[model samples]
Target: MFNKTPFKGTSRTSSGYSYDDDQFASKVFGEIARKDWQDYRNTFMPVHEIFKTAVMSDDLTKQQLDRIPGNIDAQFKQSQAQASAINERMGLSNLNTGRTDISKGLAQVFAENSARTHGKERKMSAIAGANISPQDARVNQ
Candidate 1:
């Protein structure tokens, strides 16, 4: 048995048996499969991150927008109370017109806030879109 030359590469083990072609091929195929899986995961990871960012951004914007009406209402009430106190002190009961001015100011503030929020949403979307590679775009589509 010591005079016999084993096939393929010599074994590193003490058994002295060489690897058969099938065994070698099986190991290579397994390694190739593992590498392919790793590559597939790497390719999709960025796409997943981009998608997560987009979703989070939309959610954050929605939360901000939803809070706006309540905030505006609260601010308007506070301003109205202050205006009412001033009018009371001045003994001007007919000048409840302060409510109209308060409404206008609140409306202006809400409009400005909405514009800024929308602008921020657009910017975040642009950043997400810009980060997509050609490969990522294909994968996304």
Candidate 2:
């Protein structure tokens, strides 16, 4: 008498019989039809003809591909110039706000204290930018 056991490991049960039935399934449903292949081949066009038609009919210019490197370099240089201009403006704004000055002072103070306490003065970090702000980011007095 084969008792119904989930695993094949020999663990003694009260009625003691391991019923390990066929624990797997087969996937093959076997036999291909010749007409199916003929119909599939009939519906398809060759790659060379496809390419020929695509290139001839399309409005894509050859000069565009040739100019790719110069275009990319010009775009990147323009973006970098814009970013540098923004940074200079931001730095001047920080000097005007006095926040940058205050941060420098705080960093010095922390460094001095850390040095006095542990015999090594080292600067860690300063609060540079905000992570979160109100949706409008407006302060109404």
**lDDT of all predictions, in order shown?**
0.61, 0.39
Question: In angstroms, how far off is 136's CA in candidate 1?
Answer: 24
Clashing residue pair totals per candidate (backbone < 3 A): 0, 0
lDDT of model 1, residue 121? 59
Q: Candidate 2's C-alpha lDDT?
A: 0.39
Cα-based TM-score, every candidate: 0.42, 0.23
Pick the lDDT winner: 1
Q: How well is each residue in 1-141 modelled by candidate 2, as lDDT tens digits?
A: 765555566553322222232322211111134556666667654643443343333122223333444555565557557766887988743223445446555655554454343211111111233232222122221
lDDT tens per residue, model 1, 65-122: 5666677778777877898899889987745654676676678577658756764756
| TM-score of candidate 1 versus the correct structure, residues matched by position | 0.42
